[model samples]
Target: MAKFPIDFLWGGATSASQYEGGHNEGGRGLSHMDFIRRIEKSDKDKVFPINVTKKMFDDHKTHENEYNFPFRRGSDFYHRYKEDIALLAEMGFKTFRLSISWSRLFPTGLEKTPCEEGVQFYHNVFQECRKYDIEPLVTMIHYDIPVYLTESMNGWEDPKMIELFVHYTKFLIDEYKDEVKYWITFNEINMIMNSSYLGGGMFVECSDKPAETCIHQALHHQLIASALTVKYFHENSKDGLVGNMIARLQNYPYTCSSKDVLATQQQNQFNYFPTDIQVKGYYPASILNYYRKNNIDIDWYPNYEEILKEGTVDFASISYYHTAVISSEPDKQEPIGAFIRNLENPYNEITSWGWGIDPTGLRITLNDMTDRYGVPIFIVENGLAAHDQITKDLKIHDEYRIEYIKAHLRAIKEAIGDGCDVMGYTSWGCIDLVSCGDAQMTKRYGYVYVDADDKGNGTYKRYPKDSFYWYRNVIKDNGADI
Candidate 1:
């Protein structure tokens, strides 16, 4: 029988921008995600640009019907937290990972005081989680940065944004210190390299700046902000544990060719650079050399090094969806997200969204992370996205999701048996919500199905799929049933 720790945190994860729909209520200001529009004919199978420009924003505001802004009303969790938390409690969840929207608290990024309603909203949510004894693992910042910061100050491109972010973090620390014990500094901090607007809130088109320079500069500031937040949590919170979250893409060589192998190694290094800085408290030499060679100038503060060293995270958290294979061949499948280019792997099955399904990759990632950092690793995000059909009887038999999660859980069991110190596993999108990649609700990834459509039409009701029951048993048995 497979055995997990007695205190293993088995639960689901969600982001405020993607799951909470009350964008305008509770005195919440606009977020960068609020300005992004869903482009026509955009699908996960094709590479699309997520960058936003002034023209696109203006067009979206005037021509609302022309674009679909699904996040503006994401699953309506802002209004339905009671129902959702009850459903999660029913699933026997020991924890629930969610993000606190920055705009909700500060309204604008430069606000001197946090909105009272916003502060109370989260207090109420945390209290509800406490009612069922579900630990709230809160992410301090997700992809949604305040739109004011991006538009007025060009986001993290300005060093001043760091102080503003720290102020916001302190507010959270003071307000929710007793309620939340587990804190994640940033969500997928490395994603700034790929989607500047979503990740760092920097408007790329309006300014005459090199994309790489802008991204790297913003990355440096975010790293510092994260470190400072970690230090603050440690100093103030009763017994808070802060973590650094990154999107972990395990890359493999397409073939035995030397060139392909070298490419794969380089890709891994690129991906690990951010984590290295966060964990080791300094920039990697290879990344520094790459920046110099590429002529990417980043303005670093004199005290930045000291801040990073003093504020290392307590743990490392990661979001692992699929593994990609890299090849030296010129004509290959285009890269999906930021950083790594990829060629399809022949050994793995493909999901509807074109991600390679490799359960063993999870095991490899766990072992690799623990070996490299010697830190407790948390599988913060892992799940499959698929299309679900509801019958007239209002039931969803999603056996495929069950199989996918089961295989991945077994992989985690193997990694633990191999002596990896894993903290917990929180599957991504515990409930169906808007997809971040293309803003589609049809590409659902949840044990509980949300009754909503891509065009924002449905009763907004929640229904549990077959996998929900399967997961309940898994959690109840502490993963032994899997």
Candidate 2:
């Protein structure tokens, strides 16, 4: 087996909203994620509802049900960081990719001073990682925006959010400059186009402006905020590497027809436009054409061009879960709740959640990203979400998870061999936590299992699964043992 680089960071990725359970502790205020409740739906209905309306928000806010909100209490990582970091250290994690809760620090987006207790909580978490000699890759803002921002100004739709987000980023960089060296400005930034409610906290039904107008305007504000944050981090922090995170959903032509190929190209362009602007520090001509064709006008400031140029990211980071197929045919059966319409691929196996398993897609994405932008690429999020069964003996076999990871790792190694400047791979949800898709706990994606269920009934005890030992060995051998 080909050995990985000695300094390759082998670790896992997690977000604060999905893992941390102390929603009300340490002076934490409600976030947009806190306002979102997991709705009951049939298996036919997608795991998460993509189209959120103002009516749904209104009903959910006043609803009498208590358990509708699943993320209110995540896997309890807030109180279990010590135990979790110990497990990560045992697995030989060289780095741990996690996000800082923006709401935790500035309870409300307009706060001039941060919550001291909330600041101390993250300080303690970073201290724990230091004790284990694990490098922390902290994301400045995940999907958890301050609920007050959305309620008051309709999230990023208002240009004022750019200033507020920059303030929050400055505070974090100033306080944690010594502890965190790797920073990501946003999580899946392009999702703002498709999942505006969850990604940008913009409620379309509540906005007086057109939905498309609001979405694009919010996206512009976020882009500005991201660039400003990157520029500030490099200027203030010592030796900090700031990057942009995007959902690297690779698209394949469903058929050999030219139309299918064109469709795939267009879809891929939409996915890459955000990263292109962030990395290249300017809008691509294709994106400008797209805006004109759609009649979407962004509110650009006088210094916006210079801001982007100065704020270009040092590297590019992506979250790769599954690949999608695109076809030009109008009658294609579209996947439910997918950001892009996808045709079923006959060559790949489907997961329980209707995602296609394509390890080679990982290599394709890595190569494509490297070829487009000559910067180090990081696989910040990649893992399988399956129905893991724990036997009566209190052990989870999970050979399937090991197999999934091994195939992906082999694909990554091939990408490295193909001259892709890959940085490291961080498997998503290294420890069991709340699922972002369905907000369910049963969708397990961790090597270490947590005793929790969808209804939040469990001791929250952490246990090492069979894949845990296998991963430890793989790390011990530096990715050669697998």
Candidate 3:
């Protein structure tokens, strides 16, 4: 039997806003996500309604814009974290990847004093994870920012927010330097690729300005913030590997033709350019040229050069999901990438959330990050989001999810065989909780299922899914004999 290293980490991933239900508890205040709750004025707004058709994002359409559609009460993980952590431990998780809600820590963006109650919540959470010998890998900022920061302070558009983020991060390090050993500076730093607003809370507050300038400024601020974080951690001896977590949604060419290959290259470059600049400490020629072509002038801060030189990430973490297909035309040149679209999956297996299932994309992403960055990588987030049903026997026979994870694991093994220095695998959504992108509870990705409904009603009962036993055995066997 082939064997994985004994030290290889096996775990699950989650975020504070998705699971933590006590939105108003402790000293936590309403987050940028809280505003998502206000979109329920129409019946179409009752459920999470994100459609990628031509009309949804069109301003002329009378339909509700998917971006502004309200996200509902996510599975209240804030209140049920202990029970959830116990389930993760029972599943033999070695590390738990989760985020601390920044707004929860500083309700009004920047404050004179730390929120003791909010700080203590994480202390208890980490202590619980420690009880099971599970190392906690924390991400400093997930998608949610304090709406106060977004509306009042311009959401990372101001470099002062970079200073505020540094203060918050330093406070967290000082607070948890002993308990936590792995940190991701941002949840998905490159999430700015799709929609900067949705990915990192960067562009939403800048609706009044030219979007091109606003996006450029937001990217500049995020880069500076990430670099400062790395510098602080390195100088302070924070006792952890601080890296940037990126969304590695792979892109494939539509065909073997030269145009298709160019399209694929363009897409990859566009997706990875931001992190390449931050992690590599220099701008990619491709990105600089792209910005120049768009007439986007980034008033590159003077201190940023030193910050970049001093604060490269210790490593890189990537999350893999379904890949997209791109085709190139002579006249169709995208400023950022090729014209992108999803390919129809011949394999009829779709995730519960309608995402195509393609396990091979995971291996492609791991190898790409390793080859490009030349750093050890963490599989920070990957899983199947499914509409699960609990039987009368109180069991969720989710063999489909088990197969999805196993196929991806096998693909990851292939990447390892090809000599990628992969460090760990933390499947996203360790407990049945809210979907961060759309804010629905039905799409679950946990080895342990929680009894919660879309309307936020349930006993919050924890039931071990069929994948639970499979994952436990996989860990117990040390990635062999699966």
Candidate 4:
């Protein structure tokens, strides 16, 4: 049988904001994610951005941390990255993917002088990974943006955000370029389709500017930010690969009908068009037509064409979750089901969160991305999140998780066999951390399980589950025998 390339990296990924508890550690201040979690748990039925009642903060009857799920002081990776890296090393991982908290590096989000403590913290973390022979892959911005920036400037909607992000990124490159090799401009930059607040989508929502105008403006800023990041790092740094990540949620026609096919096409267009402009150096005609139909014309600045031409990425990075179904229906206008057809896939087992478990979707994503853009694709995040149970033997017998990963690996192998230019694999949330979309500890996806309760109370112990060993061997064998 064919095998995973000898140099193929096999490792797990986690983000600073998710796993690195010490939420208040390393000079890292509370981010928008903190506020987001606070409101979501207190009153489940309340629409987001509702008033944070004094009762919400002071109510002793509610869970500690004023939120139901555990986030602040998660697995305590700030204190235990060494041990975690050791565990990953034992698993034969060649690479480790993580994100640098913007707040950690720039405590207030706009600070000119970098925080010494935050810089020192990641410095130690990277140094430890280097010692263990694991190549460090860093993402500049994960889901956590500085709350100060969000509240004061309304997040990425402000053009100032592009500059701030670039400044923060430059600091990271100057500090760690000699050590770290792989970098992504923003994690899932295209997730504006889901919630604008999370992925520069709020830039449009909270703008005094027209909604379409702000969206296009935000897109321009993000594209410029990503391109500028690549241009600067490539020219200035010693050597590194820079790309933007799309949470590449693949989709299929619900049926073979023309409408279904059209739905998938439109849905993929919505998800991919913005990033395509960044990676391919120009917006597709279809996307321009999309904006025109909506009465939204993006303002293109002078020298914009030149910047894109000179600064397109060297690669495309993606996080493949599960594929969705798209059905064409013009009249549907609810917030969740409005844009695309995210119908249930009867063929696969779904998690409690209702995300389907279709490994084949991953392979399909790689193939489609390669065929469309003709650039190397990186699987930055892929995995299963489920409600895990710890057995009496003090082990998380997550065989189901192992099976989920194995099936996805198999799909990846098939994609490789079909000659897709694949780079590497880094499953999301390598060590159990808070979920980005759900903000729950119970939605656990980690090789080494952290002994923490959903209510945010536990010794914060780490235990290697069965999949941990399974993945170790998979990496060791290079996916030939998995």
Candidate 5:
């Protein structure tokens, strides 16, 4: 018997800034993503691709063609939505996770109304998804903030962003209330703890206060925005559901020692900080104590708790990629994720890019999250990034991807049998697109291959990999054979 429920969504995930081109069309304004240049392959290790500042963006505007902005020329989804949706339909997708570009609609973060052309684009896209019974799982904002917000107010640092973000959320809910039933408020909302720019749209160099201070304050405002998003989404859409997204950095203790275990426990709490606020409708005391001891004061609204309590989310979505080990010994720490510096898992084989290849981590994560939150858990982003090669017949024989996904799916099945409420799964980068880390298209995590290079140069044709047929069968049988 299949472990997955009949309504379980089997699909692929994508973000607008990572794949949707035509950033300048349909009255779309420049986003913060539009300003960042692609990192050269040789510079990927030394230079941070997203640690951007106001000065960097300003420089890019002045010297336009001197740099390569690969994201500006994405997989051309903006023009090929119909064709892409058809391919997904052919793969037997039940849901399609995608994001809307904020700047594409509002132009600037200050806009009271949206651009009609931009609104129409989504209408057609969502309608197409429905054409094949593919439910559109929409993310309202996925790392794409209008540059005007950062230029004027340093993005999320200012409390005024709450109002602006809430305004945008209302427009999306009111406009696509019927079209998009599943909405995610933000992508990886907790990443702000480390990456002030990508997570919070905060240019640290331009901030009036220290970066840490700005981040804590900005986090408060974003939490409020999410709560308000849930509030508005519930009131507006009778059947629509809202969710909170987190980048789940599942960490393990390096040793069985008490000190290592305690450190790992503390690290897990910090990793789950944002999810607790959104799901439990309140902050835990440990966080409060940390704030007090660190003197990280936030300007909380008078009715903040009330809003959080009332607007708790319907489900929790997370992006779980790899497992990083945490040790009490500081000297043993290395780079884990973009934001976290920690020890790597010694037991797991690692990817070429250093991500630990532990399919078992998914099972552990689902069980932990379910035990903690008692909410429906959606694996919104999960995939293996591999160097896929094309054979002589122009076929991509990605057996490694198949093996990776099969192991992960088995883990999901085990978690479900263990009584974890696993709602759905959407593998990340289903169609080859630019990697968020270095803007490289070569680091593929897709079942469908794109004939594009790192610099966005190619015919832009899409072909199904071997894993595509494998996934199609998995979805067809609802993982009965996994």
Candidate 6:
């Protein structure tokens, strides 16, 4: 096995809504994620409506007390940061990736000044990271927008949101510039096309206009917002860098057919579109023609393209959990949500979530990215979510997860040995937090297990899973053991 670089980062990735509790505490206003409760509002894009709408968001807020919003009480990390950080430090983490909650800072996204309590809360978190010699990689925004902005400002649809986002993130840059260096503009910038609501806080399905029209318009604003945030990060912070991120949903052809290959190419092109814009600092011709073919005309400033060109990101990060198989034959496909009707990859293992486990795909994706962009790449999110079993001895023998991550790491090592400039890997949901997609806790994806359940019931205590110790040795050996 190839050894990792001495400066290679070994850490974990987490988002505020999925990891930090205290959703309503410290003067925090509700975000779109806070009101995400189960509703059977299925669309062609999904088997069930995993994404919420403005109405569903509002309704859930009205009936907030009637349900257990797992996101609101995410591992109670807002209170358990010290303990969790200690655990991660014990695991020999060199870096820690987390998001600063947008609503937590601005409350309603209209505040002239950030809630000092919210600001201080992050200060404390980053201070803890510093104590452990852990570099903090802060994501400016996750798949969350303040409920107030989404409701009143119509979220990213209104051009005003770009300014607001710029303002909000500018404050974050100024406040945390000294503590944080690597900042990600958005969690998944391209997600608006697939998950309009969670990606941009736009109720695209329920909008008065065409769904594509609304989505494209909102995405236009988000792109500009992202670009502007990158420009500001460069200007405000001396040693800081802003990077682009997306869910790297790599697809393989189901068969050796031209139709299947073409379909896969199109899907991969769309998947790479946003990052391409962020990295190259302009929209590609293919995506422009795609929008035209789809009859999607996004409204944007004439100069927005120049803004994107001026504010290209420093690096790029991706969250790759699994791969999908795309087939042109309809009968061969099965719906896996997000408007994707995919086929099974016989060569890959399957997760409980029905996602294809393709370790080799990660290496291929890494090499492709290196060749295409020629910039440093980081695997900010990758992990297996499995049903865990806690033994009578109270030890979680998550050998499956260990194997899953080990295989993925070996693939990463192969990519590195193949001369791909891969920077680091941060296992997603490093400490068990609420799962975002399913809004449940049972989809365990952490080295350390959280003693919590779907309804937010449990001791809320932390226990090291079997992967924790295994990963500690892997890090201690710096990829030599893997």
What is candidate 6's CA lDDT for residue 403?
A: 90
Task: Write the number of the candidate with greater TM-score, choosing between 2 and 6.
Answer: 2
Clashes of each: 0, 0, 7, 4, 0, 0
Please, what are the lDDT tens digits per residue for candidate 1 over residues 300-388? 97699899898888899999988989877778634433543446789999887778899999999999998889888899999988999
Clashing pairs in 2: none
Candidate 6, residues 81-134: lDDT per residue as tens digits? 999999999999998999989999998888889999999999999999999999
Sequence-dependent TM-score of model 2: 0.97
Question: What is the C-alpha lDDT profile of model 5 across 211-303, one tens digit per residue?
Answer: 677888888889999998898888878997789999887888899989888887887888888899999999888788777987777778769
Please name the candidate that would achieve the greatest lDDT relative to the true structure.
1
- The estimated TM-scores of all candidates read 0.96, 0.97, 0.90, 0.91, 0.97, 0.96
- Write down the lDDT of every candidate, Cα atoms only: 0.87, 0.86, 0.74, 0.75, 0.86, 0.85
Q: What would the per-residue lDDT of candidate 4 be over residues 120-193, giving only the tens digit for each residue? A: 98889889999989999888888677878876876767778778888988888888998899888888776654
Residue pairs in clash, model 5: none
How far residue 20's Cα lies from its native spot in candidate 2, in Å, is 0.2
**Per-residue lDDT for 396 in model 4?**
85
Weakest lDDT window of 10 consecutive positions for candidate 5: 334-343
Worst 10 residues of 4 by lDDT: 43-52
Off by over 4 Å in 5: 42-49, 333-342
Clashing residue pairs for model 3? 19-77, 19-78, 20-77, 20-78, 21-76, 21-77, 21-78
* Residue 28, model 1, lDDT: 98
Clashing residue pairs, candidate 4? 157-203, 196-201, 196-202, 197-202
